[model samples]
Target: MQYFPVFLNAQNLDCLVVGAGEVAARKVELLAKTPATIRVVAPQACQTIQAMAEQGLLKWIQREFDPGDIQGQQLIFVATDNHQLNCDISTLAKAANIPVNVVDNTELCSFITPSIVDRDPLLVALSSSGTAPVLLRYLRQKLESILPARLSELAKFSDKFRDKVKAHFNNVNQRRHFWEDVIEGDIAETVLAGDNQQAEQLIEQKLQQDEQTEAGCVYLVGAGPGDPDLLTFKALRLMQKADLVVYDRLVSKPILELVRRDAEKIYVGKKASLHSVPQNEINQLLVDAAKQGKRVVRLKGGDPYIFGRGGEEAETLVEQGISFQVVPGITAATGASTYAGIPLTHRDHAQSVVFSTGHLKDGSIDLDWPALARQRQTMVFYMGLTGLNVISQQLIKHGVAADMPVAVVQSATTDKQQVVTGTLMDIQQKASEANIQPPALIIVGTVVSLREKIG
Candidate 1:
């Protein structure tokens, strides 16, 4: 975020390049792609720069850099090998309040150019803030290969009808939906195939038939364990399209920031034995929002069905005759365990894994301790930090050895992650001493012992 990305208007722009080397020539070429007036000043000129000057592409002043050279320039570029010269120009540009870029020097740059994927009107620009240039180049290549060659044609076709579509939809959300449909549907494909006439006809026919109310739907998305990167592609897309978002306590702040900016957000996060917004009320809230034709996103942490109560929510949606889709996410048992360097299941240590909820609706610690206390199987208990003493006692009472290995992971997969390991007998005391909080996963079995060697 050091350099805010913006597409500056280049029409009638005044641009200056203070070097005439090969690097400077590249910057000049990029500037020439726009309608800007470019001037290059240097004691020597490269072949490419000289050729461009002869073709009247830019004004090449055959002189060394001077303070007066930057006057009246809206943008400046310095790509010389002389560090002192670049720093001097950067200072002058700052004093005059003109945006400047010093090649390969982030500290001297007011702006850093991004690698561009030019699909004409549909342009994609990405940068790494002058760090990891090679990584940025690799990503740019991937984008070029995946993006359609004729995407520009589709963009131009959509641009032609933007005003007409705007006039048809009074609500901003409706306008967004219309454009999404047109761009993702058959009209875009027809335009990409170079059929302007057929594309226009298709758009017109679509508009004519779509004056009725659009039915509201719900997206049941899993935000994944703490890390925002673990979110599925479909989950992110639905989150961006939501008109209203209902999220839970386990959803990370970074994940919440990914929701639609203007979308109304309602929190129904529940803590142990305390429900902020009750389950029935949350279900009704979703039903009411959908009835009002608002696209709702029910964002839950981890896999929606894995003790996330996603099935309960889905049942309510079905009973109410509302349409909804589920987007699965990486559950805490998998994400947190892997990040904590404790594999849930391993070939030699454990052959199977089991996930269970530590806290239940009735505030009971009752569980099939006999089955969970068995050997050669990994046990992951979610939301179990508060009842750690009871969990350990029961397992030991139910034939589990007192020295059985155990690990507690807090806020796994995030910067705030903390891990505590000990035997089942001392794990409760160890967690208390470490002040481990809720929303933590308790792992049991020999897998906890693997951390010393591989973690």
Candidate 2:
């Protein structure tokens, strides 16, 4: 959190750049795309800067550095060859309460230029507090490769429908839900495919569906591992139809962004310290939201049934006699193993796969030692962070070999993913060294040895 990010409207503003070298030329070029009055002050102007000045597009001040030159500017850039001059401009600009960038001199500047991803109406600013611009630029390049060129058009398309959605859905909450439907709906898919006609048609159909599905219903959607790309078609379809999305903390942010921007997002995520919404209350909230005829999506991170407590949620929905659907996603065990390059059940190593929770019914590590101690079986433990040591010690105590291979995968299937492998006797130490935290999956057994084979 080195630098606070803020978007500035440069249109019709006074912008000043001091220096006319290559660095200053770049700053001027970036500013030229915006509707701003740009003035450059430098002893020698580059060919591009001079050309702009001759065309009446810019004012060139061919002179030495003057402190008063930046006085009337709203935004200023000091890209001079002289470090002292850049420092002076920065100090003067700060005193005048104007934002200034001293090229590469971060310490002398009040403002630092961020690595920007411009998708016209959609801008993503990445900054490492000016300390790691190269790394930030690398990340920006990666993001640019992944982001579609049609994002601006899609954003404009949604904006066009904003008024119509509000006019049709009188209630604020219902309207918000409708927009979420729009984003997850066929409209987004069609727009992304460059089919405006189909997109509009999908929007119309969504409105009709919204009217028809007036009776509240709930969809228990598993988001699938950490990748939004891994979400099931049914899960995505339901998300597109949601009026309100109540999601857990482990669900990835990029996946959450896929939900409608206007939709009411309620985070009922429970982490170790933060409990915004408790389980029982969350269940009741869903029931109440569904009763109001609003489409509610309970977005979980992994398969609803696999250590997700989805069974409990289903029971609540059934008892309430509420219309509900379950959308299965890739469970943590399966997803982690797949991406970590470890097969949960290798034919040569493991005969069967067993999924177990390290945290027991009493909120303690109470695994069946004999069952887990057996060799030649793949063991996937979910929510094992709190009980890793105990689980490890018990298995060894129950005749399991201390050298049994184990792999701890944190945030599997995500860009921040890390796989740390060791034996039961040393896996915890490996995890500690790697700083492996929850929102993780643990694989224990001889099958973990398959990493060597796969690699």
Candidate 3:
């Protein structure tokens, strides 16, 4: 570690800032977030700094920064444009036994500010010891996407019950176990979901229960189409907390990487010609894992409820009495269509959207041809690549126009995404020529034509 990381309490502490430019203004803004008594001394002040001074947020001494300004201050910030003056300020602060930060000059900095993800009570800071500020900021942005905005709410809520929990579970290990379960289980989920009353009630109930025993639960999380960015904050949180992850083929590799590293990952992915693990076996595996007092995650791609067999898994969990929560994701139909620039519904084209699975249990392309053949409606078929020829022939034979536009989007929303477009009369041939693969979406409607205009 280049620098020992520490968080200082800024409340009611006198802090001195030497400058009034953009950098100093930004420093003041950060300090203002705390209850620090800030004093800025410079030859001139920016409009924002002057406004803050007039509003009594800070004291602005309109004069050149001198060694006297560093007196009686707990911390110092040197943000002046002049390099020599900044160095002089840093020297004075160090001489006075005060910690000082020289902006943009890491060599002179007694302390450096980190890129902070401020979820209030749950703050995450990233620092490169001033060697790579941009990299720190990039990492902060990644964390911002994964961490829930309302995570602080859970922290605040738990604070109210800390004493009660501490009193109830006197044993250190028991208390630690209890808190772990509470934070990784439904209590935290309820609080994160904005149900404070339910969360508090659940917390009380747990506290009243035997702290020696811990119950296990499962989360049915949608990993989204292909992009890990599409995964919900709740999904990411549960993924990291899971003790075991049961995933499928549709779940992207990038999405699976987000799961906790220590967690056991079992692949039950099913391909068109392969079933590595049967559906019943996968369901039983989740139940068995939870029975072992483990937090299990049955992660699926796309919206779990949307033909992802999540309903079946959820039903099995219910019968087995395993507690679980479902986190939705961006399904292929919406994700593929948008990325391919084909609107699923439009006033000038499609009025209604229909989603169907092209693959059937008994290996047959059985669908309501007449209903799907209707105009002014968009149809999206999942797992339909293998049955594209049948789908095209059936639709065209069932009173649908032979020239109806169709599009096949493969690996939708991913870098490998490929789109093949043609009329119903020749879509199968076009898809074959493009060599479109599985995990693709098939769109059949006039909306397919819009891809040319808007794509």
lDDT: which candidate is best? 1
Predicted candidate 2 versus true structure: per-residue lDDT over 1-455, tens digit per residue? 56777888877799999999888898888888788999998889889999988988889989987788877789998888887777777888999999888888888878887777888888888888877778998999999999989888789998988898888877766776677667766778789899988898878776666354357888889999988889888888777667899999889998898886666899988865456887899999999999888889999999888878789988999999999988899988888998999988767888888889877666877778788777788888888876788888988899888998889999999999999999989988989989998887889988788788783
Q: If scored against the real structure, what TM-score would every candidate get?
A: 0.92, 0.69, 0.62
Most TM-score-accurate candidate: 1
- State residue 318's C-alpha deviation in candidate 2, in Å: 4.8
Two-way TM-score contest, 2 vs 3, winner: 2
lDDT for 155 in candidate 1 is: 83
lDDT of 1 by residue, 1-455 (tens): 67799999999899999999999998999899999999999989999999999999999999999899888999999988999999999999999999999988999999999999999988899999988999999999999999999999988888899999999988787888889888878999898888999999999998888486788898888899989999999999888889999999999999999998988999999999999999999999999899878899999999899999999999999999999999999999999889989988899989889998999889998998888877789999999998889999999898888999999999989888999999988998899999998789999999889999888
Model 3: per-residue lDDT, tens digit, 1-455? 88988999887799999999888999999898899999999989999899999999999999997787777999999998899988888888888789999999999988899889999977887889988878888899899999988999988997899898888866544565578788889999999899999999998887777555456788999888999998999999889878889999988888988998878899999987679998999999999988877788889999999999999999999999999888898999999999999989999998999999899888899899899888898999999899999999999898889899999999999889999999988999989998888888899999999999998
TM-score of 2: 0.69
Of candidates 2 and 1, the better by lDDT: 1
Worst 10 residues of 2 by lDDT: 205-214
Alpha carbon lDDT of residue 446, candidate 3?
91
Ranking by lDDT: 1, 3, 2
TM-score of predicted structure 3: 0.62
Candidate 1 Cα errors over 4 Å, as ranges: 257-263, 343-353, 368-371, 374-377, 453-455
